[model samples]
Target chain A: MRYETLREQIIALELGRRERQFIPIGLSAIDDALQGGLDLGAMHEVTGPAAVFFTQMILRQKRGGAFWLATSSPNEEYYPPGMAQYGGQPEEVISVCLPDTKDLLKVAYEVLAANVVGCVLLEVQKPLTQTQMRKLQIAVQNTDSLGLVTRGAHTGTTSPERESACGSAITRWYVTVVDWSHEKTQIELYLVKNRRGSPCRWIVEIDHATYDLHLVSVSGE
Target chain B: MQRMICIWFPFLESERLIRQNHDLATRPFALVMREANRAFVSALSRNAGNMGFAPGMSLADVRAAAPDMLYFDADPMRDIRCLQGLLRWASRFTPRVSRGGGHNLYLDIAGASHLFGGEDVLLEKIETQLEDFGFTTRLALADSKAAAWGFTHFGSTKSNITTERLEGAARELPVEALRLSYASTALCQRLGLKKIGELTKLSRVALTSRLGLDGVCRIDRFFGRTAEVTEFARHKKRLIEEEQFFDPLATNAGVEAALERMLEKLCQRLSGMRQGVRKSQLQLDRVDHETMFFSIQLTRPSIDVNLLKRLFLHHFDQIDVGFGIDRLILVAEQVAPLSCHQLSLENSQTQNREQDLEKLINELSNMVGARYVQRFFPVDSHIPERTFSRVAALYASRLEEWQSPSGTRPLRILKKPVSVLLRDGIEKMAPETVFWHGRKCHLTPLSGPERIEPDWWRDDPDWRSGGRDYWWAKADFGALLWLYRVSDEEKTQWFVHGLGS
Candidate 1:
């Protein structure tokens, strides 16, 4: 019933004549999970350890632009390798390493106000407060740029304010590193909340050696 | 004879304004502070002496004279700036006004005296205007800077002197009216030259020898005997252009479009004057008289409309547009004369290349950012990092295109490489096992113990853990990582600095 409504809207708007929106991280399962990639001009929370997936997603080659805010590792030397892992040119990558939460807010708002960067990733350990998140959401929406915040496991801890920061995030995804013993390390991704669509769980295998992710086929039919 | 006018404010008034408060203009206020046994009044408010207050009077004596007077400490430098601002405002009348030695103005109204009717009318107009603005000005007119400076000091109290009677009246005035220093005044007194007419009797060389060069020059200038260098106060150009919006712009696009219109008008004004602007100040006025101002500076003199638009495009989102934007203004400043480039037929090739380079820079800047789009240039330095300085948003060609002197450098230079721990004191000696980030790892193979010295000039002695020696070490499982050891006062410590992957 939902698909019929969406199809009717697309047909009514004559969207078939237009080209497909080619977002780089267009995995079928992830797209369906995200309800058609991250919405333009919105905030998404992708929480994990030293989030390399978020890095790749932001560094994706696009005609527009990409921005990365890495705070987990303060050193600028670590950015090139992560960007190179996704076949993105290191020289072309723009990353801002904000030292603290205050600086993060200042730099993020500036990036949004510029309206240059198509994708923005802010990696922070402690989750932002509701006020901070509210301010950032307004900046992103006003600029028409997609903003992603990466947080650690305790992002949704007992502190309701901390939970509210993630709650204000348009979508939230849990990225947990699963050890496959002899097999390559796999990242088990769980869609915690989908504001636009239904939530689902999926396993994506990551080649630790090559730093690549493969979406696994669920045993259905 | 031609005429000039002088306006004198007693001491430095503007500098002591904050302390003087409302009393600065109305009451007989004096900014008095004692340095030694002598009490000196640094600044005096309007009609201070008229209200029976004099500078250099003892604090006790001043209290006896005007007991209800207010006092303040004076700053000479700030008063000079405020005076300059007023002089700039006055420049609209004439360009020949010169700042006097001590809180006085000297205007060479010689050729341009007829603009404001006669010299008396002009002086009256100036005095009345200044009086309306809460300033007490003592006005005088004469044929020369020295002659005018002389009359205003002495003649203003004696008789009603106008520009018509200045030359004859100047001759009878005391030589002390010339504003000569103590030595010059003493020399004039010793020579029995009590009047301007008596000093005019001496030869140029004789007068110079007796009164010194400055005194001779002033005397010569006032008498029209020699040339006088009258320094005029510079006029700052006020280039203000504004756009009145019918309906306040609420969207970024609307504001940006409005700004573009303003920028075009401002650039046209600049270019029409054969000038290229280095900086432009933009003001966005919203409802209720709130103003948002942002200024942009070009790396070089630029009149290109597209470049200016691109730079301002980033700041459009910052406008509030609260209750809607009512007006926008762009002011051209730091403008310079731009020489037009004559193009040859072959110049088209070069122009096309420049256009391509500009496009590349704009695209890269848009992709990364204006702050991040940088170009590195080689410098005359032995150190690797010091060899280049990042130039933000440069449209020049890549630096590596030109051949450079070869130097040894690391494939991966860390942005602040981590401090490490060494097992033993030896640098070349391989670590059998190393613990890093709470994990123990065995080394399979090792290479390099390159020493890197700390920049002693920049390194803080308190925070200095000492110099580091980096090494490329591989684990048994084929995990290649970079490690470094900090040689400190106690011992060396090794740390897993970075991973090759």
Candidate 2:
């Protein structure tokens, strides 16, 4: 009887894994490379100069409340009116300010574990260990929540070994501004690590009026 | 005749300590008050009293007699607050409740007795509830406040004295039952007047001349000859639930279990009242006479026990159980009426999602702090930084619709603008090259010199450089920066305020 109960429990666990959904990024090429889209209950890392804008754009696609965690440093100011330009409602976004990186990650873990909000964005200034990243990964694994982490600008280059060391995140993207003009701003997203598919790059134009992402070019799968 | 009930807590201070830490109830406990650097027993438990320790006895003598006695400094203010809380709790039995001194509560249940059966049942109910709360109370019901006070102190633990028996009851009690001044009691004892009946046998003029008018009036008031006025306490009943444990809880799981049960009871009470809690406080009384307090606030009033439990358990690690926690009290400090909503058959998923969002907000608010988690609201101001304000997420009810400014704002704005150095002198409308972040970069003005002036009425240090002409400029590295130039009297200063992309 115990063996049969254990077998039934394993079946339920498998079904839960199969039922996990994917949140599409609204770009066909990028979504195709991501195997339909980003896994709904997983961690994704974004880093670079335009990483905040890219993260905000991805958060705009989700349906529920979003939490943005940042440190209390004077340099880390998030302009809500500017964020509204990226289709994030000022009222729907809950901004949390912690005193340090440790508290930022702690609150991020709590927010992800609750599985209530649709997305959590952590502005981490320091590098995280594999254990820290793995803890956050496990927190969001069972919930329909997305954990989006953006590294600080001062943190130097992301080497391949360091990327492989902290491989708990399901996907990692490096954002760079390609073009800026009065009409539109274009950013290049480099998918350095994808657990499910090959790495690729996509150039997208940000619509300031409608706050939508338009695909311009795709390269290097 | 008005019916009055006087419930006197004989060992108020010691019992309050015992109520908080139940382990002290089994031991000999006393509360000491120091006068002129000499400690004296102010209150003693029944066990300590049985061990021959009395109030007003020197602590040194008590320690010599009973070396195993545990004592603490008496806090009269906390005792008074406890009495006031009991008064509020007793208001459920009758609305006309008043405090008769530090450790006594007077209930003027003139006609409000039938709701809980009759007078005897009401008195019994009050006694049982107080006992359940770990208070040893002596309750008495009589026709007058003086008579009720006299009976509770000197007559019986529980007594119902009628108008016909009031005279005889007063006759049997001692002269101290009249509650006279200390000098009058001493004089009465010296004059061989031991009982109220003996004092009443004396002539009125003789009594007045010997004991003074106030003392004579005290005797008159006891026998219903004169009316006694009492100031009723304006007691407001709170939605509260609490539990006392036989064994103190030393583990987080035990505390969480007790908290969960208390939350269930409190939520049920709130639901019965058709109200929801907006802010609630949890107090843990440790075995060492210390208290740990936590306050949980919600984004919206909620009666959901699971949400409250989750919010509270998130902070369970912070509870330092000094020795152990013997009592848990949950009080809803702020509540609002929650109108019942019929669940929509089709849109229940949406409702559940919204509820989930609220739970997330509450949990995040508690994890950091309510003030640290905030939502932004637009303000009707023209200043760049003053255009929006961050309000705590839990308290942001009605937010103004965000109206985009005419000029395009940047995705990230610097908290304080950084000054930029222009290589070329301030001759042109805009500088071609500027040094920022210790790097000299060429600037190409993409969009414009949108003029923004500071609020003239307010003194702002950041905006003291007068009006600024903001420009969306591009650096040589293809990064968009929000640059603004402030032309002061002496020189033209340029500052990079934000990042555009």
Candidate 3:
């Protein structure tokens, strides 16, 4: 009886570990660097210009719908038609616009805890505190859902310390516009913090027509 | 075989005023209406009536007789609303409650009276309830609605006349109880007929010749010879659960406990009926005789007790206990049939996930607003701003297929276009550099100017600039911007409409 009980506990642990799967970023180099891809059931933060676009690309990899929570600002409105250009289903996206920062955080927690949607993108103007971040992380940890947070690049945080201040996020990234030509725009993505892998950087080219990102160069090479 | 009950509020307007402001309960108050520049009393309080003040008495005469009496302009609309509320409340006794001409209500309580033991018990209960609600009422029951109305207004304060005695009882009342026109009543008095029994002696042809067919019909209706059609109040079956406390609850915990108990009972009832509540109301009756009400609307029908408790607790702190609550009532104002789904073990997880999503939508909608939580659908329009529209997530049935436009679109669009200044002069095609957001940026056009015109059938203010020539360009900062130029009889102007990533 004691042996049987021990075996059952071991099986349950294995099942729990298996539930935390990773969502591939569609780039083979990035996928290999992160040991498959970004972890589901974990919180990730992305900042700098084109953060929303990158987040939309990552969300398109998931199967189910996503909840987008943002403040009710005219400048922050996402164009559904434009989002569709990146392979996002406009009808499957549930958008919530809240004027209050507190309400935005509360709704973000609720959507994460619901664990029904595949992804949740929260755009917050104010920086979240360590406690708020941990609370949200704890909420999403119970389910196979991904929490994506995007903040303004000018939020008064330096690169190194900003990564350390992320209390519960599994990974932190900063993407900035580098240069552009007639057909493609070049962007630099820095993997500032990765819990399970080494930090890295990449220079990528975005095709305007297809909205696809091409891996141009790695940091070491 | 039909039994009807009529409830008459002799001082409806004054009683309604006193119910709202209890200070005027003992005071002599009157409601006045202006007629030909003269203020005539339309309704009087009990004290004012005892002081020999009657309706139609001019305000000047009443003021002279009782100088301290209070009078205000009558609100007929408010009185009608009060009567309508009472009509709904009276449906507890019988389903068929109809509104009388003014200040009176008729209830068809034929077989429903037995539920309250008998007609006498039902009438007593109605009178006591109305009295508790601060209204002075006179009630009468008879074999017909006309007889009931006649007996309530002209007979005793509380009378139950059976079929054998309905004619005898109505005959003793004045001819005015027949509900005839003023001209017909005057003609009856001119013929020396003061009572209904005196008019019954006249032949039908004689009465019709002297008072017209309308007068004869009124008498026939009063005597139960003619059937009178009445428009009953539309009553919908409601699921209500309430608890009355001997000791008023003063703490938030106590109220929450009571609410939890009521929610459990209500959920059980809904489940048994295969229904769920879409909208619900919570009413708290305080010890001070004041009632507090809170309402909650859901995105979909739900019968989950815990979910309902969480939603109701959102408004629990807003309740001011005042002197404590003596009674709690929960009413499901709207309900819909919800069939049970047979879920397999494998599908149960998926079903629960869907339910969780629905709960999340409802919670977020309640927190922010239903309108703020929405999904986008493509509209059949070419205008950049009119390409899509938002519908509340609760109301959206399914994901609509988004028809992608032929050309590339921006990831984000500005709510209002910001004007951009051109560097150097505008070239024949497109500007080589532009000042956007206070920064000079070089632009390389990757696509031509796709001309889009406004819909001619409708006048849209956003498209008031006439037609637009759109261009997709790569800016110096590596950002792809969507630019539009509008040219009319005036000079050409450029604006940055969207940002592409």
Candidate 4:
């Protein structure tokens, strides 16, 4: 009887469901602002004057290892001070960067689809076309991993894609820097789409002293 | 009125404690005002009270009452801090906590009595602790807060009042213990109603007409006729663990050490839940409006704090502690029941080989970028040019492909098959006969043609010249090549797809 049970279990193993998990970002303000932390199996877009700050926050929020792929033009620089500022260690951050955009995307997709990466962060210049975005979206869903794509406006053209790919992503966010001046920086996070509920937005002031982002306010749009 | 047992420790200050002992716990012996300047005798030591001192006496009068009665000011902050500390220690008894107004801890231990072997045992435990702390605690448990308050102030040792039985117990207590305002007390006196029992028997409308809303509320609370909700501040989201540092830690190492401890505490909690975390978010909250967060992701679901801490070490460089981190919070998310691994019966050699291959591929994939790995897949066609497809990475089971049964394929396939001149309806597809370096005359064998139609779906009008016939040819030089004939051309296009090796 035990052997029969064992045999059944072994057979079941080959057809097991994909497991999804989440780690709450310790920032109560952000966690409350985000409703809960970023959903573990979706793409979160961080865009704004300083998307890097929230990206760092999200990266720190996911303590599960992330495969970070940063793409840049030859002359462009990516000297993000927060990578080290938020507990991102040298070894845990796997970077695959190249001068070519397609190669970078190809590499990003390959790494994310390997099923080993817990969360993936890809920093690109412009918004990817609908078709290109769909390919990446499919890759992430197929592998059951969280894929966060960071597209900074300063890098180049910022245009909305025609259509997003299939796969009912858990959540999507658009991080925008609402205000920054006089030694103070405020970030506005817009939840563009969420299948679970209506969209929400939160504004946070980035503390220069501790590099901590504070919840200045929130608005449900 | 749901029961609220608000335990008020009147003489909580150790130095000002009116204890039954001499040299009362070392400092100046005086029951400092509860809200100093509010003129309520918060605490009174035996020495101060014995020297003809009493609560509510003006400080000047108290000074006059006992010239040598050493007086000290009351500190609400310190008292509340001490109260909170005591409450933390008391939390082991129950999860509910309500501390409001000074030195009053309301414990709702109504339903939890039997759990600790009944009310007497629970009260005994509290009493023993209060005694150890040298506090004069007036313990009361009643169905209503006001009645409980009356019992706390007036009941004697034998009262043994439980919340369920407090209504009758409060009848004999003086009306003053009802905590009626001085004005209400005066009105009650004017009406010649001095006992709580007398007030309880009065009509509600009559009570209201006499003292208005305040009177009605007081009577309602006192008679257990109204309900009160005591808001106990709890963590917004459930907290696994929390720690604070007096001095803000500025260095990464200091923060890491603090995080290490938090992880340990978090792991203990997660393990108890019979679960593991897939991700842990670390927040380094600083005092001066600065916060840094580090999120670490685990490859496998785990409850192991050590491994979590180790993973966070990688992103340690990202945290920018502009000022210093005073508080640290680690929240583990994405929890799941840890699946147990069952090792297979497959022996060491096969397992070792698989492990070696996986490691080798992983290393190469990481080095060359994961996109660069590739293997060849058979393209379903007899024509040499359409024979294979390139598949990416270690996803392929193996690179080996079956050779065409009747043909000898080549050492190297041209990226695009090249067309060459033919001699009299026969193709010069043989590498030996078709002089490269001008050497010919080796034993060459050529196979008959296998035809292949154009891929009409992919056919460009300009590129669709026609169908082609393919042949497998061998030369004495040990090279096997694939040659094809375009029907329109008097030449065969030669391409190499594979070697026998």
Candidate 5:
């Protein structure tokens, strides 16, 4: 009886199409691939080298309070005041640096579940297992806030294969900085996995003056 | 602006335990004193008072109302010490702070009330800080000390005493507020005189004959006709708050809780003085006559009570409480005036950002070791490693103007450069692939050969190694690596210097 009642509500949201509502990420090609924009009220995993830039992109895309949950990895220190240079209010970003990845994930889940923040950006050194992703996914089920997990390069173990970090995320992205020169900072974003839309790729340019995400080319180009 | 502020602690003897262990803040508690065969309530907690328990009430009546309430023996000496400590704590607000009779404290703000915005704000600050330290207090501000003292004891609890309103407020209180002798009070009551106004209605000469000179004198003091002279103890420039536990605490949790209460009191004292602590000492007195101490030194003066508690909590593991910790004392060893930053209307957002960053830095320092948390400051050195130096995050530098990097640099740089391992067949200069991190480092040099010469003047051990030739490379394995080659007089060496996004 419980499962039936739960399924009926699930069917209800599906019929109403409220479950797929997204706050647009503001670029046509990216938005088209995302089936609208960034999926709302769900966890999305963004990985790779240029993930911080991608993380800050969502900060510019989303308004209101943004919680940046980082770890005490001396190498990967977050300069929140530097966010002001990124054209976002540094005061709006509440940065929390915890001891380990477990605490980081715990804080991320708690913050997302609370639904008090407009956007939560979690940068961790470890990839999320399926269970961890499910826990994070469960947290964002009720709120319209954006939960972005920016997975950094994990340097443990001997396995040559890259950990997919695949979980129950609505979408998974791999960001790579292709060009960071005196002229322009170009990046390649690969949509490795998408729950609703087809996988796609795009090359975007980070504007020098505005720091806005500009789509330079698509997969065909 | 010779404004006098009176702070009345109604339950000084009762709330000591609750102040130390605020867990009992809401629970009903009473201070019982026995005389002959009868027991009486000497003092009650604010919660107990709210339930209609007053000093001098019979213990039988108290237990009949609430049987499960906790009780303690009356300790006037301990209560006086606590009151004196609070009096000393108020010295942070003004130099003219003085101890009053019983549980009251007086602060001669004079011109200083405007320092906290106004008299009302200063009173609110005192009330809030004292309440945080687990005491219920009544506060009032008046032009004269007598009126202020009278207003707190006798005036309506909601009375906000200004000089203009002092006269009316003092009169509205009952004549018992005069603090007359028992016989005098009973005689006045027999005459159907329950208010101060009723006593003052009779001619002075008639009242003198009827109630003696005490009634006239009491009324005189209430009306501010005579000077309310009080000799204040000389101000102590140091802060030391101590608490004695009846039953020794056995756990680090309890020790931390005691330390937390101490920090709250210390911070309140420091906040009043507009000063912050640079170093503090926490001493633990054990039942075995062994005393243990831990010292905390902050990078800057900060009155953040919670942060100080957390910092002391880090050193909690080092303290060994044998048998049990009987008493805990926290002393501010080093303090400096922490002037409030003037808020600008146009730059409020920027200032708030700095404040948030300051709080965040303090929180991080408490969570991690002080050495582990740092903020970046651009150094005046061309050396790749010397371009930026990490300073304690608490003392964040205001100067953020960064000298533009001559070239793009890696965001994540290792503390020490990790040498790049070369495969047997790969060329040193243009190697297509190498080995690192238990995997083949598939290297693709995007930009390279930017030689950085070491500074000659600086005498440093780490930079003793010669200059380095750097490269920005994208590995085929999808990670960006900053590879460098160290130039040695004997032989040139290769190493993977840093990581980039």
Candidate 6:
């Protein structure tokens, strides 16, 4: 038997027919398709052109101490004031900036399992392997901590067959800009993978004033 | 009910010496003082006492008894300073804490007992904390200060008595509790009247006839018949805590521990005063008599001990204790009263989260250079980047408010504008295709020509090139760019200023 820690014990206690509690993303269609809402313990992989907007929206919802694993990547870096302006509590959010290195993944693992924080978010270009995902799955399988991993918009160069073949995430989403302008911004989220139900797509519009997201309608596409 | 607490520190001089030389703790040693070309024992360690050496004994007699025993010179000034440090440490329990001459600390813990569980728990805490600092103490609490002092110095080590039983406790204690002059005590001892009870039976007139009004008043004070007016030492505002060593501490960790001890005492005193440290410094005195100092200045005052410890940890390495540090000192240069907050269990989590965030910011700013962790504050300017100015994470205070731009702004604005070039000629109204940098970029205008005029009043550098017309455009791959052209027709140059989400 593996050494059972507090996190593992929490995960074990969550094993039942009851669904996990989630912080509301302020949207009905997305929340309904998400098997109620975002689970704290499970990894929700968000990838697409408009993923940063939705990720920030989801982050503003996780109401507690959050650890953001950021890098020096020019486009990937998280701006504090901008994030705060987008309805996130900048003071409650602490960003762990890592030097340019691959060890960020390993560091992310340690940070996730520590349980000293309420949420963990890591930005990466690549997805995890089956072994790494399996380890992460067991680590947060049943806790009330939101773990998020974000992959930037995939340029046509990378292959989807390798990672999308058997998605290890509890839920995997791909977002694309349907309509973006100063007056309004709309994103189409394709639910590429879901552990609890079938994959689907939802068109959502972000309220310019409050930044709260709302689903306009569901699309078969 | 008003209760008096007396903290009795016995043989403080000897303890101070032993603290500097911990090697003497287990050995038989005596602290000696020279008087008229003759050395007399002033204080003796536990082992020396067991071997039959007592204070005031001639050094020659002590030497005859144990020729191999060690002896150190007693510094009365050092003993007083160490006692002051203990007084500051005790102030954490009650703000009405004061010194009672050389070795006793007095605290008026009237209604403060309940705050620390009770009188018994409070006393136990004092004992434990003192023990941690390598001191042995006798503690007593009573309704009268004289009774507490009597129990502590002359009677027993532990005495927690109610006001009703103050007479009985005082009667059992000897005349030493009165703290009388040596001649008076000796005169009483020779008269077959040593304990206070024995002297109480004598007529007041008779007692006065022999020992005068001072002696009779001492007895009345002990019996609670007359009030004992103890001239409490005025509190020293310049709170400085220090520790000395005979064999200097060689490692940085050792210095850190000593510095922590000093900080704990200093912070405790500030907290007792309901004050926070605004500026403080740590001084490390080396064995070779060189002093090293590290100081910190805070924008807002704080009394958090752990926060002070963490801040000092960063500078622990820079302290050059050349020949090992023999002394550590901490001084609170400036302090301000801590504002009261209505504490609640619900807000405890929020409070802890805020504290953790502050700590993380401090540590992160220290880990990476402060520039890497930055927060932007608003500045009154028309330039996009100048609208908000970057400040070090360490210095960013509570942000008041940020004015949102009237129009849409780019998500990622480039630091420098990339100059755009016309594909065929410079006379075009808007470039259908432009040689932007290395690539032949095609630009389709989404919004155009928001003319911005230059402010001729001020000598502006960025706008000095000329006034510009701004446009939001889209290039290949749907990249949104903010393009601007110089207002001057002769130099109608276009440049990509920023990128939109």
Over the stretch A1-221, how does candidate 5's per-residue lDDT look in tens digits?
Answer: 79656754673353233555578877888888776788778888887766666776787878766777777765555543334445554445556666788866766776676665578888776677778877887787777788998767524231212535346877888777777653456778888887655678898988755666788888656
**lDDT tens digits, residue span B213-256, model 3:** 88888877877788989899886667999999999999889999
Q: Pick the candidate with the highest DockQ.
A: 3
Please report, as a residue range, the 10-residue window in candidate 2 chain B with the lowest summed lDDT. Answer: B397-406
Query: How many collisions per candidate?
Result: 9, 0, 0, 40, 5, 1
Candidate 6 residue pairs in clash (backbone atoms < 3 Å): A40-A145
Give lDDT for model 2.
0.82
lDDT tens readout by residue for model 2, B1-501: 689999998878888898888888799888889999999999898889998778999999998888888889989999888888888888888889999874889998888999999999999999999898988899899988898999999997799998998888788899999999999999999999999999989899999998899998888788778999889877568788989988999898999989889988988888888889999999999998999899899977889888888888878889998799999999999999985667999999878877766676777788878889888888777777877888887777535657666568888788888888898998668758987667777878777788998889999988888889988877765456888998866888888888855
RMSD of 5: 22.3
lDDT of each: 0.60, 0.82, 0.82, 0.58, 0.73, 0.70
Clashing pairs in 2: none
- Quick one: ranking by TM-score, best first? 3, 2, 5, 6, 1, 4
My TM-score estimates for the predictions, one after another, are 0.49, 0.65, 0.70, 0.34, 0.52, 0.51
Question: Which whole-number lDDT from 0 to 100 does residue B250 have in model 5?
Answer: 94
- Interface alpha-carbon RMSD, every candidate: 9.4, 2.6, 3.3, 25.3, 5.5, 4.5
Q: What is the Å distance of residue B174 in model 4 from its true position?
A: 1.4
Residues B1-501 of candidate 4 have per-residue lDDT tens digits of: 254566777666653233435455554466566443455555566555665666667766666656766666666677787788777766666667678675677777767777889767887778788777677677776677666666777776413565556667677777788777899889889988877777878888888888778878877777667776677646234535667889888899998888888888887887887878766678778889777766655434677666677667756777787778888877876677776755578676555544444433444343444454433445555444455554433344444433442233332234444444333335343333443223442424345466666767786452366775556544333333355555455544443332211
- Candidate 1 whole-model C-alpha lDDT, 0 to 1: 0.60
Error of 2 at B478 (Å): 4.2
- Docking class for model 4 is incorrect
**TM-score between candidate 2 and the true structure:** 0.65
Specify the poorest-scoring 10-residue window by lDDT in model 6 chain B. Answer: B363-372
Q: B1-501 in candidate 5: lDDT tens per residue?
A: 457888898877767887678788778899989999999999888788888878899999989989998888888888889988998899878888888787889889887877888877788888889888878888777766767777788775524677677666666677677777788889989998887777777899998988788767866776667666767779545699999999999999998888878888888888888899888888899999899877766656889888788778766767787799999988999898885679799988757755654554454455454555455566666676676666655555445645455655655556666665666443467545667667776677777788887778878676677677788777664566777776565755666666653
Worst 10 residues of 3 chain A by lDDT: A152-161
Residue-by-residue lDDT tens digits, candidate 1, B1-501: 445677776544742473346545555667766687777776566567677566667777777777787766666777787677667656656787778778787666666657889666667777778666656567676656666667777775323355467567877889888778898898789878899888877797887788889887777677655656777876666677788878777777887887777777777888888887667788888878899987766545667888877776656666676788788888876777775656669678656544444454453354334565454444554333454445564434443322232322322234655544444345545555665434555664445566666667775552277665656655433234566666556666665555432
Local error of candidate 5 at B446, Å? 2.5
Cα lDDT for residue B390, candidate 3: 88
